[model samples]
Target: MTEQVVTGGGRRGASSAVERVVATVREGVKTGRYVPGQRLVEADLMRELGVGRNALREALSRLRSDGFVQIEAHRGASIRRLTREDVAQLYELREVLEGLAARLAAQRIGETDHRQRLVAALESMHEVARTAELPAYMDENIRFHRTIVELSAHPRLEELVDQLQIQTFRIQFRSAAANHDRTGMREYSVTEHQSLAEAILDGDGTRAEDLMRRHLRHTRSGIMQLPDGDFA
Candidate 1:
């Protein structure tokens, strides 16, 4: 009985270690610490994450399932790089999902403290935009969208949006980095974000949806215009 108990505890500990590795790797990819197509050395990951080979492999497997990593037969694991077609397809889905999230948030704006929170998020975006720091602006930009998703009060919708956002994180970061010098584009994005916030605050579901779709469409256009080398 004691052996069984110990075995169970070991399993839980291993699971926790795998989770830590997974979260760290995911955050690394999102923050650009791990760029697309970069090889992931198992020995390095094991050392850095302080996990054993088995736990590291398990974490990599989970990441692979989530479309964050790719394990080629002989090439080992590497960050998954999105192709041009992949970006286009992801944007197409994002438009629908995010638009729906915006509409739902607008419809439910008065049901909770979402109003205050959303206003705060928009203000944060404005403040970050003034700094002209790409990383801060990107962080606030993601926060603003996440606030709207939370306001939607739909668990499944939030989960779906979160997954899609994670998958596109690298692409979005790269696109933004490439256009970091385009001050006009940054200003325009902030303006559109304000317009989106207004629509949601006013509880105009239809307008909120329309604006969200339009915002994503413009972003997609900009990403498409990037040099061919940007995509796989």
Candidate 2:
């Protein structure tokens, strides 16, 4: 019994370590610290994350299943890069999913404190945009969308959107950062966000859904304009 207890505790500890490594790497990818196609050296990860070899490998495996990492037999692990078709298909799904989320959120905006949360999220985006910090703006942009999905009050919908958003994080960050020099583009995004927020707050479900879909379509168009070298 003593030996079994020790083994169980050890397993839990390793699992915790792996989770930490996974979260760190995911955040790095989302924030553009790790670019697509950049190799993830096992030794470096092990050192930086302060985990054992086994824990790091386990974390890499988890990230691979999450579509964030690609592991080649000989070349080892690198951040996954999406193809043009992949980007298109992802946006197509996002348009449907997020549009529905916005509609539902609008209908349910008065429930609980969702309205306040969403308003705060939108204000954060505006604050970040005013500073012209692309990274901060992108972070708040993600938070704003997440707020909408949370306001939808649908567990399964939130789960699906979260998965899709995770897969698209690096792509979104790269695309936005690449166009940071274009002030008009950033201003346009802020305007669209404000419009979407108003529709949701007003409980106009149809308008909210329409605006969300159009917003996603515009984002997709911008990503499509990126050079081919950015895609697989």
Candidate 3:
């Protein structure tokens, strides 16, 4: 009985450790501490995340599957970086998927609180953008998009978009960084997001879809303008 209990406890401990390491590493990526193409040293990550080597390794393996990290023999792990083609291809898919998501969400959003949630998220983003809080603005921007996806009421669509969003997060950060006039950029974002929220709220599916496509196109243009070396 004691041996069985010990084995179960060990499994639970490892599970918890894996969860912790995953969350820590994901947050680090989102917050830009682990920038695109940055090498991840196992020893430093183990110390930082307070996990054993085995658990940390397992967590890094999961991140690799999630497309946030790449692992290779001899080189270990590093954050995944995007090429110009990657940016183009990703945005192309996002425009289609996100536009469809918006249309579906406009049709189904009344079934839940997602509409109000989207409005609140946009308001929060506007407030933070005014203050020049890029991180907070990005957080709210993510929340706003997530709410729209949730309102689509399509599990498979949500899953796919979630994965894409994770991969494109660094691109979004770089796009924001490339802006020379942050105040103007923030104002533009607020205006665009407000219009998006309004279209969804009105249940104008066609308009919502078009607006979403336009918004994504604008972002794609900005990302493409970034120099090649910016990705690294």
Q: Is candidate 1 or candidate 3 better by TM-score?
A: 1
Q: Candidate 3: where is the Cα deviation over 4 Å? A: 1-9
Q: 78-107 in candidate 2: lDDT tens per residue? A: 989999998899999999999999999999
1 against 2, candidate with superior TM-score:
1
Cα TM-score per model: 0.92, 0.89, 0.85
Q: Summarize candidate 3's per-residue lDDT along 138-169 as a digit string, tens digits.
A: 77777788888888999999977877776777
Q: Rank the candidates by TM-score, best first.
A: 1, 2, 3
Each model's C-alpha lDDT? 0.89, 0.89, 0.84
Worst 10 residues of 3 by lDDT: 131-140
- Summed backbone clashes in each candidate are 0, 0, 0
Maximum-TM-score candidate: 1
- Candidate 2: list runs displaced more than 4 Å: 1-4, 177-181
* Candidate number with the higher lDDT (2 or 3): 2
lDDT leaderboard ranking: 2, 1, 3
In angstroms, what RMSD does candidate 1 have relative to the true structure? 1.9
